[model samples]
Target: MKDYPQSVRRKDRQETDTSFLHEILDNAVSCSIAIEKEGYPLIHVAFYHFDAANNDIIFHFSKHGHAGDEITDGKKASISIYKYGRLYTAAKAVDFGCEYQSVIIYGTIRIIEGEQERMQAMSDFFDRYFAHIPDSSYEAFTAAQSKPIHVAKLRIEQWFGKEHALPAIATDAFFPAFPSVMQPREA
Candidate 1:
């Protein structure tokens, strides 16, 4: 519920806007979830389900991982999604640079208990990753996998973002206003 300005101040070269943030969430199928255990940082890669409607994130893992165990305990986890925006440049006579957008979400994890919540979260994941599935197959496949997976929801506390631009001033919807920075010249 907390806005970007109230959460944490981030410094980056990319303009964090609404559209850019949405794109990063769209392009990414999985997210790297970072948590801490016994004072050490534990980061695990996870397939994520995002709800743009309420800006919520969902993830599921077997009862195995330490992250699942250490999720609550008054500590929050961080999840990030990014893309490799590599390209070649002709005028510069070199590869200019890769452009990318990323979103960092801070939230508390709550283990999903009811079948309804779990199935709904799974549905979100299915829509994002398997949008191409045929109607019958999709329903059947979901029915099969639904009972097997244990879904959990991440209640977002706050969020922030960063990204790269080609012209350095490209505007987007999900990202915030990116301040232009001048790289320091070597003496």
Candidate 2:
């Protein structure tokens, strides 16, 4: 890898801190994956887990969808995860904005193959979303009855992270309670 790609328009908002990227991923439960098939563009929204240990984006999808067969290694893919923060309103309509933390990863998608790895990924997914279940129940279900699902991992080649925070100086004067002007305001 490369770091940030040339695609992000707002260069000033780009963040390089590894922890910031992890933070965004940690807080997000869903992501939007973009792929191309048959010379057309496609995007899929799915639940995901960010495996920081190996820097992988893990997710499961139905085995019958277009993704099940197309999302294989050596294929280009991109995933975007975001956290919504407070809305940022400016006195000027053109300056209206919002606070957020987001990460976009561009990489190759790999469908996990081995049973053991698939099981481990399943366990991680279960633990992440249903940690309250009794350990015995969880283990038995995963170890014995869990059928193989289509789990895919994206090997990140380049990533981008950006965040928006309201400046401390931002006050009521900057963000009005109502719309700026009923008419156009110069930028």
Candidate 3:
């Protein structure tokens, strides 16, 4: 990873372990990318695959979508992935905070070209989301590739990981568990 100027205010919450960063990237469900388009911020959320081999991130969008229209080749962008945990409550309102782990990647985007590379990139993306399915299922993905989709890769130049967590034991400062799923309401 290229060295970038440190900007995180809380050094205690900053994480430097490469393995931990990789783990978060592998498990994060989705990521948001921020780009500057015509002096305005354009943020797009999408499912992505962390390309460990090339140290890049891969994603796709409809060719007619806003992202496809605004994202030019070699555009500078930042990607963020995060997971939230418990919400900690304190006697002082200012102290209240939530547990979270996140990574922010600064990189440049490239629109992928050529049939073979695009097919492989999309295939890797499919496997990341549906690894349990058999190879035969890939036929469906292959068929879908004919649609008007723009595949792009983010070449990572720098990245930083940060986390804030609470102790396992409960204390006066109560930390409520964050629900992973919402329950259905019953009459």
Candidate 4:
């Protein structure tokens, strides 16, 4: 890992364990990439595969989309993956809190060039999301190989992880019930 500056304000919540950080990266449902387009910032969320061996992330987007036009080789970007849990209610509004785990990575994007490398990255992506299914059971991967997509890798240079877990069950402030949904309002 590169020696990047640490600027986390809350040292108590700062997570420095490598294994825990990697776990978040591997299991998070989606990641958000922040990039600059035409001097303006843009964020794109997508499913990604965390390449632990290479210390990078692999993802793809439509070749015809705005992301395809904005992202380029050697472009610097920031990627963030996060998961949130139940809300903690408190009598004081300022005391309200929510459980969360997050990992932020700073890196440069590399548009994959070689056909073999691109194919391998896509295969790895498919496997990450569909590990429970047998490889022979689905033809979607095979079919998607011919699609017009740009498979790119985010080479991580620096990363930081932080988490705030819910208080113990003994704490009455933590809401243990399932979250209720809001009903649509009629005009």
Candidate 5:
């Protein structure tokens, strides 16, 4: 798919599964993680890297509040991945359709330890988020900064995904846009 055309030009209720997640991860960089500490709601906006084999999305953050300490075991962590890529025309805000791909995964996160695993986790994040990090920078990442901080990883348990686009009418019209669902397929 060159763009979200399949989702926009037509609507047929595109199905999704683990395969779809890999695509979303490639296009996404940041995810919102909502956690609660001491009965208070906490939301962390952090960068993450997705792993296909283990179906896990990993994160490393500086020692903040009790890192992953308060949540119940197997609790759901809501993580949303979103995108809006030139789906709207500049002149018209109501061109009501947006080219968007999003996935909300409710997963269980585990606090990771072990020096070797920690090092690998951080390295994996660098390769995914900053593929352009030079060799020297990578060395620095592994050598010095890998320690002192903490890493928490979320294992993807279930995900809900949707792909969206504007209908042809809205695509041609200049303004006064409204979102329209695709008509059902004929029997």
Candidate 6:
């Protein structure tokens, strides 16, 4: 594995463990991919497969969509996958923060065009999300359903992982504000 460029802003929070990076990718249900097009940055949420074997990510987009139109082979893109954690509060406003594990990947996108490879990538994607189905029927089903889908592989050139955590000590009579997901609902 090659060394990724470190973020000078938060050197302490950068994560290097490859296992932790895989965990974040495997556990995430969706990712945000940012692509630059004509001086504009377009970000879209997509369902992706983390190919640990190839050290890349694969995803599908609708044919004739903005992604298919804007993104092509060798295009540069950035991917972000994250897991949100609890909010951390402090007596001082500047100290307030939140816990999170996130990874940013810089890569060149490759559009899988070969019939065999495209089908295989599509199969891998379906198998990841639909593991319950047996392989006997998977091939036939995928072949029939894959016609309208376009698959692209993001070949990871570099990536950085970061995690922010609060020290395990209580502040002086301070109450931490909970995240919206953790807050109670109103009747």
lDDT of 3 by residue, 1-187 (tens): 2445565888989997889889999989899999888778999999999998899999888788788788779888899999987776666666777789999998899998888889988888878888798877545666355468888999988898999887444234444644446765557
User: Can you tell me which runs of candidate 1 are displaced by over 4 Å?
Assistant: 1-12, 87-97, 135-148, 166-187
Mind giving the per-residue lDDT tens digits that candidate 6 earns over 1-187? 2454556368888988898889899988789999888788888788999999899899888777788788788878889999876676577767767778998998989988888988988778777888897768744655557777788999888888999876554253333454466687767
lDDT of 5 at 156: 80
Error of 6 at 75 (Å): 0.4
Estimate every model's Cα lDDT from 0 to 1: 0.67, 0.78, 0.83, 0.82, 0.67, 0.81
Q: How far is candidate 3 from the true structure (C-alpha RMSD, Å)?
A: 3.5
Once superposed on the true structure, which residue ranges of model 4 sit more than 4 Å away at CA?
Answer: 1-5, 167-187
Scored by lDDT, the top model is: 3
Model 3: weakest 10-residue lDDT segment is: 167-176
**Which ten contiguous residues of candidate 1 have the minimum total lDDT?**
168-177
lDDT of 1 at 183: 52
Residue-wise C-alpha lDDT for candidate 5, range 1-187, written one tens digit per residue: 1222223223353536657767888778888887645577667778888878888888777664554354334555778787754344534565555566787777787767788887888878877767785776534555465666777788987676777665554544243344535856557
Candidate 5 off by > 4 Å = 1-14, 37-40, 65-75, 87-95, 137-139, 142-144, 171-187
Worst window of 10 by summed lDDT in candidate 4: 167-176
> Residue 70 of model 2: what lDDT?
70
What does candidate 3 score on TM?
0.84
Please give the lDDT score for candidate 6: 0.81
Poorly placed runs, candidate 3 (over 4 Å): 1-5, 134-139, 167-187
Best by TM-score: 3
Candidate 6 minimal-lDDT segment of 10 residues = 170-179
TM for candidate 6 is 0.80
